[model samples]
Target: MNRFRFRIRFEDRVGMVRDVAEVVSGHGANILSLEVKPGEMHIQVDQVSPTVLENMLKRVQTIANVLEVTPVEWLPHELAQQRLRAILDTVEEGILVVDARGTVSLCNRKAAEILGLGHSLIGNSLKHLGFPREILTSLGVGRLSQQEILLSTPYGRLRCLVKSQPLVDEEGKPAGAMITFEKMSQVRRLVQSLTQPVMITFEEIIYASQKMAEVVALAKTVAKSDSTILIRGESGTGKELFARAIHMASPRRDNPFVVVNCAAIPDTLLESELFGYANGTFTGALKGGRQGLFEFAHQGTIFLDEIAEIPPYVQAKLLRVLQEGCVRRLGEMLENKVDVRVIAATNRNLEEMVAEGSFREDLFYRLNVIPLYLPPLRERKEDIPALAWHFIQKFNQRLGKNVRSLSEAALRRLYDYDWPGNVRELENVIERAMNLAQGERIEPENIILPEKNLASKSPSGLKRAMEEIERQAVIEALNQGGSVRKAAKILGVSHTTIINKMRRYRISGKTSGQWK
Candidate 1:
């Protein structure tokens, strides 16, 4: 028996669909399904010979006002399943389909690998396969959403981020369930690839200031050692850049150089991010667990940015790893020895934190083995012109403008400001001016400086004032455009830049113009 589906288009008239159905049935073909719409009818038939099908097609064409008739490649159900399989196969995540009784119906290759099911998975019961009872119960109740599952398979213990939803029948009754599995390690790798791309070297640290040059020279010297190095500086003083330069000059430069911002990740997640969990350590943990940034940076360097923001608990664990040269995954008894070089950078004063008992003194001493201080942009004013030109050339290529140089007046304005954000601020300012510059030379007006009164009010520190000004600018731009992309265009920056700034300032579309 052969199955076929076809679309027949005809003039709008009563009983035209009935006539097609009659023709199909008269040709000894069984009509499986028929859908009638304005001027068209889609029909699926089973148990039809090729000769009889051709005769039926000719008979249908003889009907009055019949415009076209074409056979489809697959039956409706077959086409839907084929499309679904194709989509599932293309995704990196694993996919599983189970019947209403919790028996596995289908599993994709990724699912098989992640679950250690080998090549055979179908017809197996979730409970018999060593799946958690909670998952089986959730599937029975049709309440399975996204949850982490730990599976003990022939291959090994696997941790998987699992999401399940019931498949509904025509009457909206649950017929089965479909679950997706994503390995946490794969997710971590993807995120790392997208966010951290270290390409900077020691030569890329453009500076004419003696203070910066001395700092770079010291950093180069220390790069030869595997000791823990702590870098101290004001925010935006190119701390991470210096860390990257150190990594590039080190003997382990060929390996991965992983950077983690302690302040960026929440306290609860930071521990797992640094020292990955073992299989079944927590709900929603990836199958077979994951390798944390420390493991990923094995035999290389792990730059802990904003090290002072690390919670006390994680600080203790980190100190242990530094002293013992090994890390134990959460919930695992065995410790894995790692040969990683640690480079920690923080804008905050660690000594003060240690005195206040906020930062562990032992960890502080451990990280500060060879402390490197990066002077603020205000203290290194001589580097302004060189850095400005460096950015001009950079933005010239990025923004596609031939900006030659900053005018003398523009240079004076840049030198006057106390660059509270340090090199990062200067880079942003120069990029902004390059985008707004009408001619080859950037003018003084193009260099947007903080208000004199606002800067004076924050004499103890200009960081807060500068942040407020930036927040206001982002809010105003967002208000004018009502979208991040449009606001980025109005502000003469990339869409991602605006987004990151919005996140930094905690600005949202709904909360525009309101400062916290």
Candidate 2:
């Protein structure tokens, strides 16, 4: 059978495409594919001779509103495939495709060069090609996504990031899979260039309190070592800042310092994000897989913030990476060695979690190799003035404000209140004051504190009292400011937070008088 492609230009009226298809079918030609655009139809057909094709075009031209019909060298599908092949070949990354039965179907030149395979890899069974059985099993399972796997090829032990997706048939059944590959060395260079090093140094950690000073001193001391450091503190205690400072002080300061918030990423994706995945491991995964946070931080540091929030299943994998200095992507069994210093921070009490069996004791020990506890803002009250001035200076530069200093009354108000939100809260309060303050110095009125009456009444729990106070403050701010943005500015919070609080408190604009 011969193949032919036709480009038919016609009026973009309804049924115009159908008429073109009918003409091809009338000539005893089977339609391979059809693509319709604004005023043109691209059709591919099989079992048609040049004379038959010309006759078919003449018949198509006779249709009303049809302008022209021309034969092209390549069919639409063939041209698309050629373009795709050209694109894949041009890229430095390697591409591989496999059938559902684990046979190699297609591979680009880059793949052959990277894996040291022959030019023709089609129809070869992956198992027969000496691929690791575990990797083959993972491909068979078809659930892996963005995994990293080591391939022992003729080129040597290649640590490649592999990402795989299943090609489904019309019935939605698995037909085959396509994967892309990238060498770890290449990935490392890319990651290193993209990832900025930790700029916060030990000198940047401003503290006047002895407790904070001691913590900084310990962090500086431990920064010189390769031990895993666990930063324990309450939320908003600047644990990540300390972690960044430690990374800056380390010998691997020049390398990538990657940070991953365990609580920010969903549990389903956290593993693959940290360990990466092999190509063709799962459906809809990125081509060539991706380098996980651990892999990206190889030869440097990875700071896992909110470490206690990591799910139990991922905890075991993390423990392995910590102990073995290597990580295996979600599906592949081969481990890629990494040289990374881990710094995990958590506001939750891991010891209590271990006692309750919610957190692994072994993992805790591995993470808590050198424990550094940061004092909360209230505990380090003496540092409040300095931190406040520092934030004032920062905001002065950031917001283009020239507020000179904080009033004694404002300082006293800050000192009097127990900062449940820690240093982060203080920074926010200063920023808000800087934005709202009309005078050169921040006054007590400029400081947006929680409702003292609500706080005085609710002596039962600090957290509950703080919430009540915040809710009341949001209500009052909305009433006074008359707009969400204005209220958010007055309350030192985001407009989204103000809107959320209004919803949570069941307060409406009508009740607050008016909303702009």
Quickly count the clashes in candidate 1: 8
lDDT of 1 at 272: 96
**lDDT (Cα, tens digit) per residue for candidate 2, span 65-104:** 9988887787667788899889879988887788788888
Where model 1 places Cα greater than 4 Å from the true spot, the runs are: 1-196, 456-516
Q: Summarize candidate 1's per-residue lDDT along 263-316 as a digit string, tens digits.
A: 788777999999988777899998657667887777778999989878679999
**Ten-residue region with minimum lDDT total, candidate 1:** 507-516
Model 1 clashing residue pairs (backbone): 148-284, 158-287, 158-288, 159-286, 159-287, 159-288, 160-286, 160-287
Badly placed stretches (over 4 Å) of model 2 are 1-156, 160-183, 195-198, 453-516
Models 1 onward score TM values of: 0.54, 0.57
User: After superposition on all CA atoms, what RMSD does each candidate show versus the true structure?
Assistant: 15.8, 17.7
lDDT (0-100) at residue 287 of candidate 2? 58
